[model samples]
Every structure is written in C-alpha cells, then in structure tokens.
Target: MRRNDCFFVSTNIFSTGFCSLRKIVRWMLVASMLTSMPVLAGKTLDGIKARGVISCGVSTGLAGFSAMDSKGEWHGLDVDICKALAAATLGDARKVKWVPLGSQQRFPALQSGEIDVLSHNTTWTLSRDASFGIHFTSIVYHDGQGFMVAKKTGISAVHQLSHADICVQSGTTSEKTLNDYFRAQKMKFRPVVFENFEASLKAFFSGRCQAYTTDASSLAAILQRETRNPGDYLVLAEVISKEPMSPAVRRGDDEWFAIVKWVVNALIVAEEEQLTQANLDTQKEHGNAVVQGLLGNADDIGKLLGLDRAWAYRAIQAVGNYGDIFERNLGSGSPLKLSRGANRLWTHGGLIYAPPIR
Candidate 1:
C-alpha cells in the first residue's frame, strides 16, 4: 500500500472497530520508544561549546547576591549559579565571562545575545516572565521589599514614614512597590530616584531621603558593608511585597532552558542528599541510589539534559550544593550573616525544594 493509505488505515482502525490487541501493543511500544529519545542540544549550547565559555550577566554590585571582593573576584549567591552552569556545560567552572550590568541593562543584554544566561539578582514577576523574551529557570532566592533608615531618625515603623522622601533605584520593582505601598496607605512621599545602585545608596546615606528601600537581604548587606557603623541603621519589620529572585535565559531554546533549570535542581538535590564538595568523590563511589544517580554513577540523567553523565557531578564539585552556596555567600559563614529563614530546604520547614533526580 501507499504510505498515505497506510497512515489513513492505521488512524481509522480504532474508530472502525478493526484494531487488534497486538497492534495496540505495538503502538504503545512505539510511543514509549519515542518518549525515551534523547534531547538534542540547542544553538546556545553549541555556541558556548564553540567559544569555550559561557557569557553570564550579573548585577553590577549587590552584596550577598553578586559583588566583587577586595581581590576583584566575584563571589555571591548569583555568581555561584553562573559558575555551576559553566561547570555543567563546559566541564570547568572558570570558563565563564562575567558581564556586570545595571538594573536597566540586564534584560536588554540578555535579549541581544550578549550573554547566554542572566544570573543577576532579579525578581521574577508575572509581567517580566510573560512579556520579556526570556524564561526564568527557577527561584533561587525568596526575598521581600523593606525599608532602611538611620537610627537617629527615630522612625521605627513603615507607618512612621508618612510624606517622607524615599531613596530607591530607578527602573526596579522597588520603585513601583514604594509607590503602591504609600498610595494604598493613603500617604504621600517624595521619591529620590537614581539610575545607579551605588548612587541610590549614597543618597540615602547622605540623608537625601528619609528611608532607603530595597530587598530586605540587600538592605542588610548595605547596612553591614556600606555603613561605617552598622548599628546606626535599622531594617524595618514590615515586608511589603513578595520578591522571588530567579535566574533567567533568553527564550526560543527549550534544551538550553531545561539544562539551566535542572542544573539548579541538581544543586538543591545535592543538598537534600547531603552531598558536599568535600565528600562528593567518596559519595560517588558508595553513596545511596539517589546520590549515585545525582553523581552520575547509577543513571545517565545528564544525557536527558543533552550533557555528559558527569554534568551534575562537576557542578557539585565546583560550587558545592545549594545550602553550601547560601551559607558561604549569605548565611552565617559570610559577612552578610543573613539567616536562612525561607531559603532552607522544605524538610526543614522552608520553601527550598527540588524534584527527584531520577
């Protein structure tokens, strides 16, 4: 029979009551085979491999999220994400070109292919996720908007700042949230907006504005690192809005998107498996089934992500797990000294959770 005749006959067999059990089983087997096929690597992965580096966009300087130290080395929670991606894709965590971008430049740089992925401390919102030509991989940090004021101001609460001048960075969600909050409270305030993150902080510290508003974690960092005396500033208890910070990549590449998404998931899974950089090699040899799968010992999970079997193993080896990243960058081990309040694993009564590696 012709190919078209065969296709029509096979499709109509079920409706015509001519289908047999053997044919049904054959179709099911074919479906299973098709579903088990490996995913093809996309152009983004191909370009990264050709160039031997992954271009990553990060915040200009935000302590505990993305900042440069005295040695000019970038170290933060977001920087670690970029390193993990580099390790998974290029087999070397150092094979990354870091592009520091301001608030307004981050999205345009990612959209224009100047960067393969954006690991900046960006909040995931409905409008940005749907409207931008980018896909948010996952929420790596859960944050909220807050206010900071000098202790001498004698302002203790959000309600105390009625008709006050608030310092905020322009082209950010914080600016919008500040307006929304005050308008809802039936109050008025003068906005001291600056395009640069540093300028905003400078203006606030110089007493140009009554309060400085941003993510609570960022406020803590600023208070610790920027202020000469940290005890003089206060982070208010009022959290105005939910800010789920996530890394994003340009759209139109499902394979690249899946690779980025699972690389993050692998970090979380490593944390759940109690896998750390120090003991990763030992666990690879004699760990449990889940640990073995994560370390590329039992299953070829990396193949499904268009990578080698040791993709996740290399990522964990380079940056450790999610918990390790958090502790060293934002938690007690770092200068920020921020608590792992909501960024802890779900089993510990927080929101951090990942799917099974298998």
Candidate 2:
C-alpha cells in the first residue's frame, strides 16, 4: 500500500506528460491503427503467434483481483482472461506478459500497444466507449460505487456523515461519482484525492480522511485483506454508480475484437454448459450439439480467429469456466466471500449473458 505502487506513473511516457489520460489514449489510438492492417492485417493472430505472448495491463495490487503471488505468478479473475487469450493465440497459457498499470495508465497502455488488452477493473462509460476509440468486451464484473468507513466512527450510513473527509483514487470514475453523489445530496465533505489509490486508502485508514470511496467489491476485498477489525468497517448500502468492468482492445479491428470477445464469451458459455477445467475433458467429448460446436467439432469460428477449433477448449482449460473463476477468486473458494448477485448468468437470473456461439 504505497503511492507509486498504486497508480502514479511518469508523465514523460505519456501524451502531454501529466494530468491527462484521455489525451494519451487518443494519441495512441491513432498510432495503433496506423500499421495495424499491415502487421496485423492478416496477422492479428500471426502477430500474437510470432510475438509468443499477449501483454495485458492490470491494476497494481488488489487482492484476489489482479495481484502477484510471492513467486510472481499472476492469478485472479482478470489475470486468467489474459492467460486464456494467450492460450487461444499461442496454445500455451503461460505465454503472457503482465503489464502492471494504474487506473489512469491502463487505457493509454492499450491504445499504445504496450499491452494487447486492458484488464484493469475499469468501468465502461459512455465517453470511454465513444471518445477512447476502444471497444469494451464483456462485463467481467458488475459493481457499484460505495463508501467505506470505520465502524468505530459509529457512522452506519452515508447520510449520517456530514462534513466528513473522504479519500478517493484520482483518475477513476470515483472522483466524479463521489462529487455528484455528495453534492446532489447537499452534504458537506472534504475530498482528499491522491494520485495513487494506496496513498488515499492509507491516508483514509490512518485518519487522514474519514472514509474511502471506491467500488463496493474493491472496498470489500481491501477490508478482507487489510483490516484487522474487518468488521470495523462498513460499506454504505448506497449504490451510486453502475460499474460494468471489462477488458478493452483497440478499435478498427473487427476480427481482433471478435477473437477477444469470443474468448471471453467462451468462459461464460462454458460455465453455462458445466464445462469447468476439471470436467472439460469429460464433457467436451459429449455428443450434445452445443458442446460439440463450442469445443470446435462443429464450426469454423476458430479459423476466423486464427485459432484451432479447440481454442475455446484451450481457454476453458487455462482459466476454467466463469463460475470456477468467480468461486475461486471472489466467491466461495476465495477470501472475499462475495455472492454472485448480479454477476450470475441471465439464465440464473443475473444480467451477464453471452451471445450464442453458433
């Protein structure tokens, strides 16, 4: 939990140096498309094949989300997606390079081709969808903005805190959302915004601010990992903003989008079919029409993506199914212990639904 370790990056490496993520994303968007058709014209798949790995940008350190183990192996829901892309492209899941990026630097990294995809827990916004010239694929997680405050403060609801200081990570949707929520409610509060999330969180926890504002899932993870009085903190029930987090790829490349999209969709679809990593081998050979098609025995979808028919199979093998990832990282298997809630598939009464594979 440090400043530079949070989201701070040198401005010299980005467009306009400081205070602008959109500017950097814009400039890189133009560059990524310049020779995209040549190097990746027919080579999107070949480029990744030749490069040997897929480079993806992720958050600095959010436990059970996108963090490194002692051996430097990356494992998490988002991390698995990147590995799956590598498996689909290179036929080897470990053939991936993890580019640790802070919240603001993530999109720019994707546009500049520093990474093939942005896997940070970034919310898909309208402006980001249109102006950034990038496509967000799949809602990997459904979340909402919330506030975290120490229980010792005896403040049970956000409405009870008047004139309380709040800590927030800069360059996140939290900034505008926090301001709008507080101002619209006519509350008085001081904002202690920092360039890095750790700085803000540390400050807030250390009494620099009365509360920390971020996505509810993140606040829960932070509490689960860092708080001694984990029960001492309360996440206010107010859901201020809807955060549909997903991975993003550069625009103007429809095929590339399809490949990434399908790779993601495969995970969700596989979960629906009960095709976990443990059971994929058994069920992949099942005679069900959907199973055969998804496993590449029935169609040419893999050929278009520059992958073998079993690309989806390889993806599920690398990362398991969507439910496996959820249970392992954010659900029953992990420390977070979060309920599926809105992340469940449509058939299960959740909002996340994938397109038909056929």
Candidate 3:
C-alpha cells in the first residue's frame, strides 16, 4: 500500500491492522458526544400518566384568567392553557384536575408537587425565577400593574393617588410594585393588604381603600364580573409595572418542562399558521409542510418531547389556537372585551411569538 493510502476495514476487525489517525480521532469524538448527551427520565410525566390526569394550579377566582362559573365549570384563558396541555399529553383536554390556589399558595403548591403545572396568571421576575426552585415555561400574557378606583374617587391618573389608601392582595407582586411606584415618585401611600383576592376586591369596592391595585387585565375582569355596575369603576390609564404572566413548573424535570413549553408554543404557531379548531382537519389535509408537520402528517415532532405523533393536533382540536383562547376568554367574545393589544401575534404588530415547530 502507498504511504498516502487510507486503511479499509473488512468484516473482520483484525483485517484492518493499520487505520488512519484522523479516522480514529473522529470515532473517539463521536463516542464522547454520544456519552455526553443528557437522558430524559420524565418522572413527572410518568406520574401524570399514572394518575390519568394533570394537576393544574390556577387562581382562586380571577375572571377572564381563571374562574368557575355558576355551573361549576372552569373557564378562562389560564384554564384553556391547562386544557391544551392535557390534550397534548393525554389526548383529552378535560383530563385536568384544577386546583384553585391563592397568590401565596401558588408557588408552595408547585414546589410541593401538589400540582404538576402552575397555569395561574403569575408574573415572571428574575428574583422569583432564580430563587423559587421552579422554572417559568413561557409568557402567555403580556400585562401591566395598574390601579382601579371607583369612578367617583376622582382619581383618573396613577400619580393622583398620592397618600391614598391602596387595597392589594398580599404575597403578590402587585403589593411590591405599588410601593415601588409610590416611593419612586417621592410620594406616600397606605397599603391595605388582604390575604384573599375577593377580600381585596371587596375592600376596594366597599370604600375601605381609595384604589385597588393588581394586573390591569385582572382589574378589567373585576370591573366586568365582580362589580355590580361595570361603569361604577374605572381602570386608570397609567400602567406602573410590566407583568409578563407565564406558566411554571418545578425544576429538575427537563422533559416535563419542555412538554409544557412546546405545548404553549404550538398554540402560538397554530395561530400564526391561521389554523383553528374549525379548520384544523381541513388544513391538515391540504396545508403546507409546516402545517403538516404540526398536525403530525409530515414530521414526527411529537416524539422529540416523548409524545405521540398527534399531540399538537389534539391540543388545537380541543381549545383552538392561542388567538381563539384569548378572544373567547379575554377579548370580545367574553365580557372583558379587551383588545388584543400587546398580546397579539408578532406578525400582527404585537409581542406574542413562538419558535418554529419543525
């Protein structure tokens, strides 16, 4: 053999006595890469499958986000997220056990394994994300902290509430943001905090406090559902803090986290593709490659998350896309009648965007 020739292997390993140094190095590198790849154990998913239901934590009672109707059926944007997750994971949207939790109880419930996922409208901040032993999956709603006062209070602007009494729910970012806003303006105010959401709303509506503070979306819901006369209350024009509401899960379960994250992304992607529950079947039949991939007709993306091929299809068939959930729960279809605003898709000049499914 010439000095420049490369060694060829036969069926018998001993036949290739001389091998190229480059080939040996390449094989060693491939082996190292394969060994370093992380294995997904999926313990949380196993538990959920074993129980045949997903335990989802939601707000005690926040209209438009999470609330139970008179019939005892839960409905809201947050509730739909759990439904989508359940549909994707278990092939049934109704296979979720909703656990109503207060602002203070949400984190503890998630940390204690009392809930598989926290679908409550909780804000994502650096401190909580770093210290809470939980991971925020995705920002489902773009919100802001604002004040809601009785129309008769004559408080039209946020700055006008200087030295006023503010009613806020304890153990929430609303309480802290209210203080920061007032202190930043060199003003003083009294915080009348309540441990329960209903109590805080009652305190504000009953004139116990001059202003009610919480997420602006929550304020809208309270005005529409809680108040006897919606016109009697007004949400101020000034928004104080950015509240990016997200779903969270406990740490140490990368597999479960990815499942939750991608389930949400799948909703957004469906909206971007103009796919809805009504047209999903038709689109699956005559749609493009991306749509086919999402519906599991082309690419089997579900297996990457340890799910079956039709995971995304089941989710969309159950709750529709992100836009459908938003409109039905928080937008014109619901009493809130709030515009998409910052929650619209990025293609439509809003902040909502998701990674590609394929």
Candidate 4:
C-alpha cells in the first residue's frame, strides 16, 4: 500500500481489507463537519464593528422619524433607534455614520449590505418581509397614511375633498394608499407627483395642489417646517393604512439581525419595566430580577448583542426608552405633539410589544 500525506494507512483488521479505517475516519470527519456547520449566513456584526462605525440608514428628511437639525446634526425617533444599536454594538451610542436614504432605495441598500440597519420609516408588510430577504424588528411606532389640506378648502373629512389637487411622493406606500382610497371612494383628484417630500410640500404650498398626503407623522413635520402657515393645514380625520414602522436588516443574517432588532426592543422593554437613565445606575446595584436582566445589570447581556454589558444602560442614558424618545421628539414636549394612541403599550391597547430579555 502507498502511504503519503494525502492518504492514511490503517493496520487493523478493517484496514487490511478493502474497508480501510482511514476511509472510515475520513467519512466520520466529513459527516461531523457537515452536520455542525453554521446554517445562518454572514459575519455582518464583525464587519460593522471592525469598521468602527455602525452605518445606519434613515429617511432623507422626516421630522420625528429622521431629519437633519439646523447644525446638520441628525435627531429623531428613527435616529435614536440607530444610536441604540451603536450603543448595543460598540458601547458608544454616537458611533454611527448616518446614511440618508430615500424610500425606494432603502431596501436595496439593506440587501446589498451597504447599511447595517435601516431606521427609515418603513412599514412591516408581509410581502416586504417575504420578498426583500429582510426581517422587521419591534414595531417602533404605529403610523397611518393620511392627508393634510389647507383649511380654506372647507374640506373637513378626507372624503369631502372632491376633485382636490393632491401632492404625493412617488414610489411610496403613500402613493398606493392615495390611489386605493380614491378608487374605493369613487372619487377623482389630480395627484401632483414629486420625487421627494420637499417638492411635494412646495407644490402643495403654491396651490399647485390643494392637499398634501403622506404618513401622519410626516404631515406634522411638513406642516411645522415647510408650509407658510402651519396652522392653516389640518390632517384629515381618516387613517387609510396600517403602518407598523420598524427597523429592518438583510435576511440570513440572524445573529446580526438579532442584535439590531433587540437593541430597539431593549429600549421598549426597558421603558415598560420602568428602567430609566436617571435611576439606571442605581438600579444596577439592586433592582427587580427582570429589570436587572434586561438592563444588563446581572449579566453580560449587552455582550450577547455585540456590545458591552452596560451597552443598553448607556442607550437608556443617552436617549431613553421608546416612550421617552416619542415624548421628547414628537410628543407633547415637542412641536409635533402627536398623540400616543396606536403607539401605546399593549396594556393600553396598542402594539408596542417587546420580547423578554431572558
């Protein structure tokens, strides 16, 4: 028999025959590896950490959700979600490179791995989930498609605006919602299409369109900032779509997706459990066991999400829980003053639920 590095020689009774122990050993090793190999694909987290910044995708400019401030500093509900991920992954909430993306481009950017997580105001629909190879995290905010019209139009309800000229963004859920509503209601209107919200606002403001339609949150932002008189426009009292705004990541990246998903969930969980920035430091010393586990006090739970144990603690310290972000950025404290109707906790008959950290 020939012996070399590529082949092994066995001297046992099986080795003497055609059935060699070396071949059996080879089969065993191959079988073992085949069964034990990792099923979930990609090294997404390590790639982001090595780059030293969490590349987050956000809306081009939606106020409350994501928008640039006067100094070009980004702040909003969606931005806070991304910052939470940075804290969970890198221990620094500010360790993020914000990538402003439009509606149509967000999915492609995520699928191509151009961004780690998308904090854009995206809806979690079944088709998007199944087709985009992306997964939705916690429902960060509950939203609905609606219309905002000038008060002078004398249109109190959404249906009352007959032959209304509407400003709408192209290639968005807003477009679909607008079409469906008009079709169902047997109504006719001129849809002034624009590629972005800024242009839509311009058209609507100039009377090229009598009304501007978008997500209710976006309408609030556009009203306060873009229009001549914020008070002159009113959001019609009809929600046309069920929008569960969430963060999404590429498919087959379970570990990485889990990290991103839970970072946002941890905020909601933290808030529901009454963990806050002011008392988080003291609570770590001695708190409820559930709160301790969630806040990463009793365990290195943060490390499990590609962050230090105190990563979640730092996030809570920086921005706060889901409610806190909403309250400060878009709630009564801010100019938006959006009500927490569908965004409240399930106990309060809303959909803001989070998984247990344990």
Top lDDT model = 1
lDDT of 2 by residue, 124-166 (tens): 8889989997889878999999889887888878887789988
lDDT of 3: 0.90
lDDT of 1: 0.91
Model 2 shows how many backbone clashes? 1
Better of 2 and 4 by TM-score: 2
Please, what is the whole-model Cα lDDT of each candidate in the order they appear?
0.91, 0.83, 0.90, 0.82
lDDT of 1 by residue, 1-358 (tens): 6999989987898656655777788999998665433122377899899999999999988889888889989999999999999999999999999999988999998877789899999999988999998899999999999999989999999999998999998889999999999999999999988887778888899999999999999999988888999888899998999999999988888999999999999999999989999999999999999999888898798999999999999999999999999999999899989989989999999999988889
Error of 3 at 221 (Å): 0.9
Q: What is the lDDT of candidate 2?
A: 0.83
C-alpha lDDT of residue 77 in model 4:
94
Candidate 3 residue spans exceeding 4 A from truth: 1-41
- Tell me which residue pairs clash in candidate 4: none
**Regarding lDDT, does 1 or 4 come out ahead?**
1
Cand. 3 TM to true fold: 0.87
Q: Each model's TM-score, in the order given?
A: 0.87, 0.87, 0.87, 0.85
lDDT of 4 by residue, 235-336 (tens): 888888988888898787778777877778778888787777778878877888877887776877866665677767777877888889989889987788
Question: Comparing candidate 2 with candidate 4, which one achieves the higher lDDT?
Answer: 2
Q: Please report how far candidate 1 places residue 168 from its true position, in Å.
A: 0.4
